[model samples]
Target: MNNIPFYLAAFLVVLGVLIVVHELGHYLAARFCGVKVLRFSVGFGRMLWKKRLGQDRTEWAISIFPLGGYVKMLDEREGKVAEEEVHRAFNRQSVGKRSIIVAAGPLANFALAILIYWGVFMHGSEELLPMLGAPPNGTPAAMAAVGNGELVRSLDGQPVATWDDLRWMILQKAVDHESVVLEVVNERDEISIRRLYLSAAGEQGWEGDALERLGIRFYRPEMPPVIGKVVANGVAERAGLQNGDRVLALAGKEISSWYDLVTIIRDSASRPLRIEFERQGEVLSVDVVPDAVLERGQTVGKIGVAVAPGPKPAREVKAFVRYGIIEAAGRALEETWDKSVFSLVMMGKMLTGEVSWKNLSGPVTIADYAGQSARLGLDYYLKFMALVSISLGVLNLLPIPVLDGGHLLYHMIEVVRRRPLSERAMEIGQQVGMSILFALMAFAFFNDLTRLFNG
Candidate 1:
């Protein structure tokens, strides 16, 4: 099935919600500060919908573009205000009040992230075991002699309970250091310390996938070649295969596990293969021609059958993380703070050329991730949203022009000087800020397309 629709919808949902939430913060702050609000706009360009409401008759609007939004308060700087309404102008407010109104938008984004994290922590998530797979030759994990079945115990003396913890620790390390010392426990209950070095190349931590650079992967248990569900009207079903059928052999070769069956099928695309199976304790044989499917750049065969559900691990491969409301709130706060700081540090790295600009992502990548996370479940989707929200908050706080932080910068200058900059100076700053913002957008978009084509 096509995923375009799903991605489009997900992108819209995520962007729309974030923009509205951000603007609402400005709107609320403006109202509380006794400013006259003229318009609240979600998205940009031509108005698709509008309504005037509240005591101020504020015109609420939804517009054509979903890329950005704003809240327009009545300000004397923008235009002349009537005598009676001059007190309600945004420009008439004290510097402190004006700054609060300006800062609220980005702060709202941070608050949203905290709330989402709180909800997710309260609900809990099923976590994977922190087992490490054998690293490829010449990689950091291999260089460290990281063994298979070694459980990641900690990173830099910090206890890491799951892959999430490990990833967070690695990201934080990337911000300020060239390497991290990992502590792992082997199958023999022996603990070892290993150093993992990072590179700006396609080495450790490329494209934000720390595992690939570290040469570590998830370790899963063996899977038997028993069919779970045969796709309706698929090759396997058409060939009379049934659920619970144990695949015995393929093309006269014995099939030991699902891995073996998959390998054979992938290589036998559009070709006839003899499949021997056991159903109801009776042996049967079927001639199946697998459907050819394009994967990556090659054609692969798929029989439309999947392995049966495996048994839950016996206390070694799974973890569930949850907390009571009070505990969850504290954890949520810590989580938000950690992620925010990590984001800021990473941005600093990118600015200083320590990190590649290719790591920057645009709407296309965000949409794709949104769809994938949604498919994973609500918990994953919420996590993705929270992460994005935090990023938005941090990005806006950067002292760049044409952004919230840029406005804050102007206000800060005004504070010390006790007067606003000249209109001409403000205009020049706006032009510079616009240039920087557009350049960043272009880079992000270019990176997005590059990943799409290469991937």
Candidate 2:
């Protein structure tokens, strides 16, 4: 109904793959530790397909809801088992082995992220150059003396090659009278320097503004717009637009590049305009009506067409590539550590009300983001999956009952006290865990609902 079949398919596939990887970690660890795995499932609920391999049962099922999944291991606490099988139950395992098994799932997620990031790097991912474009008038960057075409070499003397690196550096730095230096080179190759002071007051005032206000923009090379794909039944297709057609002008205004055409169309807002183009060395003109669409709280016009690849600007941008088997594993380990730390800090900030709870998202928000990213490309989807996987791993590691962290915490207490927790105590902990989990879910759902209604 949403015409987002690609997004839906991509999200489901990515999520399913991540779930399988995570469960496999636990299953393999259990087997290695002499604990038996009862079932390894990609999705919950009824089974669509299943197979039994030797002593382990594997299921590939389409659950009614594809939000999450789990792996079930044999445990003596759940039910009675044969005398021989009792030795293979999860509860009978050593504390060290149990910890390893419980920790493996999240570690697998981290591994997946590293591999994805490595792949992104090896394939050369696109990144905007660290050039300070024209900041909007009265914004912080403008007031801070940042100007058009000024190259941002560093933040606090830390060299930044890409826009993302600069931005992350700024966000993490303490914004108290920090001096920002700029390295500018004019057309004649004349070098000059400018120093500006950063203040918390100034930064706070410019909050909720575009990245451009923070002195950032993509360095796009000038190129004529060539049609890539013509959508069937869309405005461009109906107007006789074809692939490889070079856009020349719009509404009688001469257009030199794709940026110029985009500006004109966005400002047109569903108005019918004359579009001039060249097809096979023959010039032609057609009337096109731009369709208005709302995105990220702004209204823009679209023609439902893609532009062909053009020459990129001569700027040294940071690029990462896909990882090899060995390199991916190593990078995965590092990424897991970094993401775990970041997640913990964010959680702390959220709890202290330093960050807004509106940042919390549920399934609805996830699906929308997934759809948007999927529409962009496979790389975008992969990045989203990596981030989501990291978030999932971090969340499951929280010291809340019924979670891996909670179970680990209980084991830790048992080791210290020289005895397991009482059954009544475990039951109470389970109830507390459920209550806390349910509340978090409710809050996330409410946030999503608010966003939907507000939009």
Candidate 3:
């Protein structure tokens, strides 16, 4: 509740940036193709702001709806065009030019995603190493004898450096193969190969957390219950708890590890806790009440203190992932292309009934994710934006009526027959396309509401 304002702000920022980028693509292409653009809008419906700009006196606008925008070009099909400016109208352009103008919007989205990914890859961040914990009984990992504290070295002969790499490799293989071979190094320094079956994982259609379905979990290192940093004016700081304070116990219960402290504090929200701690060589006690906050519809306690870094080998669990400029660029392109294809494949699966429609997310779900990723950190937020950008590009490129792809499809047919479709035929196609789009939107919105209420 306290973060609603921040969340809304984040969602708006994401929406605004992506919409501008997408519409700018169409606007630029229209200009390049010599098609006179009459208006450049960042949104649709009621206009909030408008300005005439450039030699063309194009009406730039910010509108009420945030989900979409457009580049309205001078077209005889839409409205009357002056006799002098008819030469520069969109309808007067060649099939090739019109196709380029229509395709530019989605291409711009892809380019933006690529650029963002390139910068992010070069900047890098600390990533978790793919170390496995004990798998639950009857799971694939357990059946394959995957040990706790086993660090994954490779998947099907491909080197796996970070947890993301491992997960990606696994997901790619799970789509086609029944089993994947993994090379792992256990905590005892012993290395072994384990072939884990994926057929029973039930992740063929890419359902929830494929890794979790396969019983893959990260190995959590136990750290001493010591405070690394204390939030100003928080319960811990108010109770005289400072950095380097080792918590000895909480509410008469023993606290050996940071996880133990967290478990106790979370269960004792709004309740006064008698905390025993050691500051240097001096042992002391303090009465502190944990702040109660709602998270995912559940109340949890927060003391506002950061955990100290784990000792020795536990520190090796993280790797700073960075790449050179050229490598980063290549990786970014690869990432964008891969995600685009994956999205298309998933959409195809949805049409075939292999994937559930529940996976469709509307603006509400997207806004929630925008808020979440923003809260996670800048890197996470940027990555989330890039992913959404890819999705936007792919969605726009889908060959349904009323989309950029639909226009491109029309252009393709015109190229084949050497003539545009008749007005009545185009109108019928538009009606059918709109119906399909509205049905999808309604279903997606229902899914969003279901998730909210269920949570």
Query: For candidate 2, which ten residues in a row score worst on lDDT?
Result: 201-210
Instruction: Estimate, for each residue in 1-455, the C-alpha lDDT of model 3 and write its tens digit.
Output: 77677777887888888889989999999999999988999888999999998999999999998778999999999989999999999999999899899999999999999999999999998889999877868889999999878999999998898897787778767766899999999877889999999875555556567787898888767688999999998999998999999999999998988877998999889999999999879999999999997774357899999999776664378889999999999989998998898888778879888777888998778888888889888988998889999999999998888999998988888888889999998899899999998999999999889877764
lDDT of each: 0.85, 0.72, 0.88
Residue range 1-455, candidate 2, lDDT tens digits: 44456556766777788888888888888888988877777776886666766645544345555666677778988988889788889989888899999988887887788778677655656666676655545655666665555666656566666675566555544233465665654334456665644453234333333254454455445556888888888888999999999998899998877777888888887799999999999999999998887763345788877878876644444455344666656655665566667667757867876556667888767777887777777777887888888888888789999877898898899899988999999999999999999899999999878877665
Among all candidates shown, the one with the greatest TM-score: 3
Candidate 2: list runs displaced more than 4 Å: 56-62, 174-291, 294-337
Per-model clash counts, in order, read: 0, 13, 0
Rank by TM-score, highest first: 3, 1, 2
Compute the lDDT of residue 122 as modeled in candidate 1.
Answer: 90
Ranking by lDDT: 3, 1, 2
TM-score, every prediction:
0.82, 0.74, 0.83
Using TM-score as the measure, name the better of candidate 1 and candidate 3: 3
Q: Model 1 over residues 1-455: C-alpha lDDT tens digits? A: 37768877877888888899899999999999999899999988999999999888999999998899989998878998999999999989998898899899999998998999899989899987678766768877788887767889888888888877776667667655787888888767888888888552234334557667667666655688999999999999999999999999999999987877998999998999999999998999999998988553346899899889987543386789888999989978998899999888768867877667889999988988888888788888888988898899899998987899998999999988989989899999999999999999999999888877665
Model 1 clash pairs?
none
The TM-score obtained by model 3 is 0.83
Model 2 lDDT, full chain set: 0.72
